[model samples]
Target: MVMKNTESSPDLIDLIFKYIEEEFPEVQDRISELKPTIRKEFSGIETYIRQRSMTDRENQIREVMSLFNGRNATEVARRLNISRATVYRCIKTSAR
Candidate 1:
């Protein structure tokens, strides 16, 4: 026997995850206008958070690399607990 979906559209099956979006006020305007399923809103908000986190991490890597006085990439990466590829990429932009 199959259960019927009543809250949402019959054609679409949505997995609604209830969480606190109130804490993130900045995401309000971005997702509020969305007419599609709330799932898409969650995806948009999540993407924003992820991108911001990546940006913050990159900035941190650059700062840490600066304190290294432009030393070996491997050592810097090892100390920072990041990958050699990441360190090498940051080295290009970071002050050598």
Candidate 2:
């Protein structure tokens, strides 16, 4: 499968289907048919990945904030390569 950063867990399944479509064209139709069952069977895995991703993201944000001593969201965003809005959103969400 082509590898890249994914925004959420479901993007992973999309990548897998894309890989299958490219590598095994004959199974493309079958893949669609099995999508629901596959998703159901892997629900736990998806949940785990989602949780881990969120935890990692939160930890990263916290680290960046801590390093900056919570001085500036723009600076943190620059260091973290994320939007200032995202940095603020994370901070706000965590605060609650």
Candidate 3:
């Protein structure tokens, strides 16, 4: 036996909207207004991640430098898997 679809597109949409309005009344205004802020929210998260990455890099460099007794920059860079230039830069920045 074949079944015919009784609901039209508008009818289905109306039913969905009514269900949403009843079940989620708080977000009804956001749904109707539709002012998306996804990019703004994600940009804030990206900025936070960037700042955290910088802080972590600085801390790692400081720890490596502190562990340096009489090791050369090349050895320190090899041990840390960073460039010798980065080790030198960290040393230069930390001295200031």
Candidate 4:
């Protein structure tokens, strides 16, 4: 998934607006009135949580990659149940 920085984030506030607009159009005015204050409070917390999650996922993938020694990309991919392309990308990324 593509990560969004704070300036570009569309977190729970956006979701609530969308849900209100789609499912309860009659309440649209009320939702819009609440969007800013709610977004200001939640977006920072949401972005921090997302960044940490990405770091954790990348570390886990790195750990999985470290378990293989001199294995071909295809073999490593199969062992890890990931695509060969992903394995190759990981190897290239880790090298840098």
* Best-matching candidate per TM-score: 4
Question: Can you write out model 1's per-residue Cα lDDT over 1-96, one digit (the tens) per residue?
Answer: 987767564322122211223565566565544426555544534232254576787786666667566567677777888777877667666644
Give the runs in model 4 whose Cα sits over 4 Å from its true position. Answer: 1-12, 16-35, 38-52
| Candidate 3 segments exceeding 4 Å error | 1-52
Q: Please rank every candidate by lDDT, starting with the best.
A: 2, 4, 3, 1
The lowest-lDDT stretch of 10 consecutive residues in candidate 3 is 40-49
Return the clash pairs for model 3, or none. Answer: none
Better of 1 and 2 by lDDT: 2
Local lDDT at 75 for model 2: 86
**TM-score of every model versus the real structure:** 0.42, 0.44, 0.44, 0.45
lDDT of 3 by residue, 26-86 (tens): 9888755432353334443433225357778789778767866656888888888988888
The residue pairs that clash in candidate 1, if any, are none
Clashing pairs for predicted structure model 4, backbone only = none
Per-residue lDDT of model 4, residues 16-92, tens digit only: 68987999888877875788778776665734335357687687568657865757777777777878777777777
Best candidate according to lDDT: 2
Give the winner by TM-score: 1 or 4: 4
